[model samples]
Structures are given as structure tokens and as C-alpha cells.
Target: MIHCMTSFAQSERSALCDTFLEVGPDAPTLSGSWRTRDLAAHLILRERRPDAAIGMFLAPLAGRTDKIQASLAQRPFEELVDTIRSGPPKWNPMALGSIDEAANLGEFFVHHEDVLRGVDPAARRQLDPAEQKALFGVLSRMGMLTLRSCRVGVVADSPGYGRRSLRSPKDEHGNVVMTGEPSEIVLYLFGRGEVADVELDGADHDVAAFRETNLGV
Candidate 1:
């Protein structure tokens, strides 16, 4: 399991890197405040935070809603890529120490999917169920399901996986019944994007509303 998680992270990192490369320096801005450039910059900085590296990642991200615009305003894309490719200055020995391998797998895979959304459908379709489940478990623990204070329930038709739902423990009626592939559930829970591939249903008017709000966010 440990080996597989590590391999998954490495694969996700590679895929993210490839996506960044293909985005080039002039990719259009994404809907809302985030753009392709911003997403790339965020990913690179995220990988080089306080525990590692000594580049502009630590500089002020505040007041910089337009991440891509801010990045381009400061430096060119090639320079930024070169800096990121150089790796962090100080690797965190305890970065992945406190958190289990499952958490790390979740971070890499989910973030990879976020970057790939609307960019490469085929590549996004290659995500593994096991890896996605690991990610979903992490997000659930992180309280990501509390978006807009709305509760959601999800059910999968796959065998062995059984039926699952996302709810506020206190709520009786599951707001949303997320039924579909496991990957879609993971993506939906993490707020990476909409679950276009999944079939969501339930006595939850909030589900569609949540989807509407999140799809463009």
C-alpha cells in the first residue's frame, strides 16, 4: 500500500507538471478569480512552501486574487518554471511524517485532478479508484463537505464499494445522494469541480445549488 501510494503521488506530480508545461505562458484565465496560470503558480508554490525551498512562494499571496496576473507581473513563465524545476531549497523531513501516506496520496491526486479539470478530459479519466478513495477519506476528515453549511449524501452502484453518503452526522435526511463512479465522488467532495460524470439525486434542493455555486468556483 505504501509503495502504491508513493507511485501514485509520483505519477500525479508528473501529470501535473505535464499539464503546466502544456498550458504555456499565455493560457487564458479560468472562470472566476482563478486562471490556468494562477493554478500553475499555486501548485508550484504549494509544492515549495515553508518547509522547502526559498523562492517567491513565501512572498505575499495576500491581496493577490489574480494569481496568474500577479505571477506574470513579477516574472516570466519560463523563469518561474525553471525556479520550480530546481526543487525546494530545504526539503521537509517531517512534511509527510506526521500525516499518513493516505493523506499525501489524497493531496497529490486531488490537486492533480483540479489542475486537469477542463484541461485534459482523457488524462483526468485515468485516475485510479483506490487513489481517489484515499483522497475522499482525507477530504471528509478535513470538513470539506461543509461547503455552504450544506450536507450531501452519495451512493455508488459499484459492487464492494457499496452505498455511501456525505452528511452532517446530525442531519437525518441526506441532502444529496451522489451516485456514480468513485472518482466523481472524490472530486465533488474536494470542491475541485463539478461531478459532471456522476448522477446526483436526493431530496436536496441544495445539491443542485451547491453544484451551481461550485461548478464555476
Candidate 2:
């Protein structure tokens, strides 16, 4: 299990690096205000500089994280991509295969799509059965937390992975079912719904409301 996860993480990292090279530095990403260079710096910081990476989720540390990421973003774009492609430094726990798999598989996958869909909204990537199952596993684990703040009930329906009830309705719009390939569902769950290839199944109002609500971690 761990070995599979590690391979997925490593492959996604490598592919994302290749994308960075292809897109250049100024390309946009689903991460708001983040260009490809900014995203690369973020990956570098997350893997190589945990101290700054915490600010990504913590309010108080956000300024510091921003400062550090901005500095890292200023490095030559190719160098940043190279550093990311090379993986974490030996001194970091992320250098360990287990930790890298646990920490980066979903993250790199999401950011990889961020760049892909950001560059072309119509773009889509087909995942193999194993990849789909792996991503669906991530969704099954994180779905509740990711959608807890949503105002309506949420059900995720990924074909071949079974369905999961992520949240209960908090409004009149009722339940909204999100249907998509696992990777697309992951992107939607991570706040990239605008570009994620997911379909919301429910009443028009319910679906609209779900989309309007900020749905992500």
C-alpha cells in the first residue's frame, strides 16, 4: 500500500515539474493569484521548508509563508522546477518514501491539475483504475472535513468507488450530489471547482447554491 502511494506521489511530482517547464513561469493556476512559478515555489516550500508551509493553513503563520514563498518564487523558474523535480532534500522528513507519499500524493495531484486546467479550462486527464481508486480513497477520507462548512448536504458519487455522504444539509436547497472521476472530484473538493470537471446533480437552485458556497479545505 505504501509503495503504491509513494509511486503515485513521485510520478505526480515529476509530471507536474514537466508541466512547469512546458508552461513557463507566468502561467496561471487554480490556486488564486498563484502563477506556475508561485505554485512551484509552494511545492518547494512545502517539501523543503515545513516551517513556512504551515502558514498555508494557519492564519497567523500565513504572512510568513507568503513572504517565504514570494522569495522562493523569485528564483529562476527553471531552477525552481528542477528543485521540485529533484524531490525533497535528504534532511527533510518528506525525503522519506512513506512521508512523501502520505503528504504529497493528493497535494501534488491537485496542484498538477491546477496548472493543467488553469492553462486550459477544457483540459481533462484520464486516470487509470488504480489512480482513480487511490484518489477516491483520499476523497473518502477527507470528504467530511472538506465539505463540513457547506450549507447543504453533500454526497460524492464516484463510479466504481461507491458513494459517500460527506455532509448533511443546512439549508433549503437540500442535498447536492457531486459526480465525477475521482481526480476531478479531488480537485473540486480542494477548492478548484471552477475548473474541476465535476457535475453537480440536484435541483438547479441547489446545485447553484452548492457551487456558490466556498467548498474546500
Candidate 3:
């Protein structure tokens, strides 16, 4: 089971790598101003460049990360796409099976959606049961850290699969249940709630607060 999960995770990342090529460098992304090329540079730097990767969690290093990413952006568009398609280099720790699974499974899933859903009237991508389960499992492990800012407790439920608490929020009104496919729930938790096709059930204020808050990794 462990090996299979790792294999699937790597496959998903690899598939996204291929997709980056198909989307082209100029494709817009739901993620800020990043066109596909910029997104690719960010991904590559995150995995291979330890300094930049840590910058994501360490505010002080963010500028350094941005500078490096900008330099990468100056590279030819096709070169950027091909580097992303190639995945992280063998020497990168992200190439390790367990680390790769932990880091890139959700990263790829979210960024892949970033490209696919960047447009107006975006197309929805359907996940197979196994894919849904994979994302759910990852979320259960990391939800608390992701939603630490939320003021209301969050319970994510996917019928016929599983249910888990994203976190215990401080909202006195109590928790709210977000029901949807695991993929959708994960998307919502990752701050893409506006585009995630899920139902948020709670007090009007709580639901509204959830929507208004900026939730993401």
C-alpha cells in the first residue's frame, strides 16, 4: 500500500509535468499573475533550490526567492516548460519517494488545477475514486496547519469515503461542515474556495467569514 501510494503520487506529478508542456508557457493561472512559465519556474526553484523553497515559509527569504524566480523567468519559455516536464533532478531530495509524495502530490494537484481553471467559465476536472482518496489522505495529515488562521472549526466530509476535521477554529458559533468530493474539499482548504465546487454549511456569518478569509498553503 505504501509503495503504491508513492508510485501514484509520483505519477501524478509526472503527469502534471507533461501537462505543463501542453498548456504552453503563456497560459494564465488561477494562482496570481503567474502564467504557466512563471509557475514552472516557481516549482522548479522550490524543489531544487533549498534557499528559495524555505523562503516560502520564511518571510525574510521571500525576496530572495522572488529574485531567483525572476531570473529563471528570463530563460526561454520552452526551456522553462521542458525543465518542469523533467521533474526535479535526481540529486534533489524531492526525488526521494516519500518526500516526493508528501511535497508534490497536493502541489501538483493544485497547480494543475491552477492552469486548468485559470480561465473564465473554467472546465472542471473529474477525479477517479483512487485519486480522490489520495488527496483526502494528504489533507487529513496537513489540514490543521493549513487552516490555522480560520476562525471557525472546519469538518470536511465526502460521502462514501471519509470525514475529517480540518481544524478547530476559534469561532464561538462553532464548526461548519464542508461536504464535497475530497478533491473539492482540498481545493477549498487550499484557499481556492471560490472555484471549488463544494457546499459550505454553517451560520451565515461563519460561511461568509470562511469565504472572505484568504485560505491557502
| Local distance difference test scores for all models | 0.51, 0.85, 0.80
lDDT of 3 by residue, 46-121 (tens): 8778867788889998999889998898788778766776777998877777887887888888888888788543
Task: Encode model 2's per-residue lDDT on 97-172: one tens digit a residue.
Answer: 8888766788899999889989998888776778777777777656765776678788889878878887788847
Model 2 stretches with alpha carbons more than 4 Å out: 1-3, 170-173, 203-205
For 3-59, candidate 1 gives per-residue lDDT tens digits of: 454455556655655666777654543223555556556545555543322333335
Give every collision pair in model 1: 30-35, 53-89, 153-176, 154-165, 154-178
Q: How close is candidate 1 to the true structure, as a TM-score?
A: 0.64
The 10-residue segment of model 3 with minimum total lDDT is 1-10
Q: What lDDT is reached at residue 139 by model 2?
A: 76
Report lDDT (Cα) of residue 54, candidate 1.
38
Candidate 3: TM-score? 0.91
TM-score of each: 0.64, 0.87, 0.91
Candidate 3 all-Cα RMSD: 2.2
**Which residue pairs in candidate 3 collide?**
191-215
Rank candidates, lDDT, best first: 2, 3, 1
**Greater-TM-score candidate between 1 and 3:** 3
Superior candidate under TM-score, 2 versus 3? 3
RMSD to truth, every model = 5.3, 2.5, 2.2
Worst 10 residues of 1 by lDDT: 49-58
